[model samples]
Target: MGSIVLTHLKSAWHVDQAILDDEEKIVVLRFGKTTDAAVMAMDEHLSKIADRVQNFASIYVVDNKEVPDFNAMYELYDACTVMFFFRNKHILVDCGTGNNNKINFSIADKQDLIDIIEVVYRGARKGKGLVVSPKDYATQMKY
Candidate 1:
């Protein structure tokens, strides 16, 4: 139900506007299907912290199937991809997964997601296009 409440970007124009129009808060776009297991998990986590990080970030969900305009540009091939942007600049996150692009996995922990969002917001505000994630996702052992 969390995924149902979050704002969904339905077109290429909307996506572009979301990226371009936000001059202050960090824009977070989740690209994937809400029906997918991993995406559902990620969306749930994102929804939980939407309010906590509302001051610094704006979360929006984009269905890859609906908005295929960014498939090759941003590489929306993952089951779930979370990308960040600020002031029309794409903000990359080094998640230690060797992919300094977008987060292509589910982060189950709410606090962990919040921490990462905070880090991204802080870095973006400082005029940095990329920020290192608080958690080295590749190094952590997942149960």
Candidate 2:
């Protein structure tokens, strides 16, 4: 239900404009199949926190099938990928997952996603292209 309400980027032009139009706040793009379970989970988490982080971030969902323009450039081959951009510059987050490009997995916790957005927002405002996540995904214990 949470995933259903989030904004979706319909075309390559909309995606490009989304990245180019935002002068402030982090542009969070989730690129993947909207029907996939993982993507749905991530989208749910994103939607829940969209308003909480609106001042610092903007979340947009882009269907991989609809916009393949960034697949190769961003290496978005995973089931669900979340990337960040600030002032038209790509913002990388060190999630301790060994991959700093984009979040390629589903994050279930809304607070966890919020923390990450906060970190990314702070780093972006500081003129840093990359920032360390509040929690280390690589070291977090999984059940």
**TM-score of each prediction:** 0.95, 0.94
* Model 2 weakest lDDT span, ten residues long: 134-143
Residue 106 CA displacement from its true place in model 1, Å: 1.5
- List residue ranges in candidate 2 displaced over 4 A: 139-143
lDDT of 2: 0.88
What digit string (tens of lDDT, one per residue) describes model 2 on residues 1-143?
68776789999899989989999889999999888888888888898899899998889999998889889999988888999999999999999989898888667888999999999999999999989998889954321
Give the whole-model CA lDDT for all candidates, comma-separated. Answer: 0.89, 0.88
lDDT of 2 at 45: 84
Question: How far off is residue 139 in model 1, in Å?
Answer: 3.7
TM-score of 2: 0.94
lDDT of 1 by residue, 1-143 (tens): 78876899999999999999989999999999778888888888999999999999999999998889999999888888999999998899999988888888768889999999999999999999889999889964322
User: What lDDT does candidate 1 reach at residue 13?
Assistant: 97
lDDT of 1 at 53: 94
TM-score of 1: 0.95
Which of the numbered candidates is closest to the native, going by highest TM-score?
1
Which residue pairs come into collision in candidate 2? none
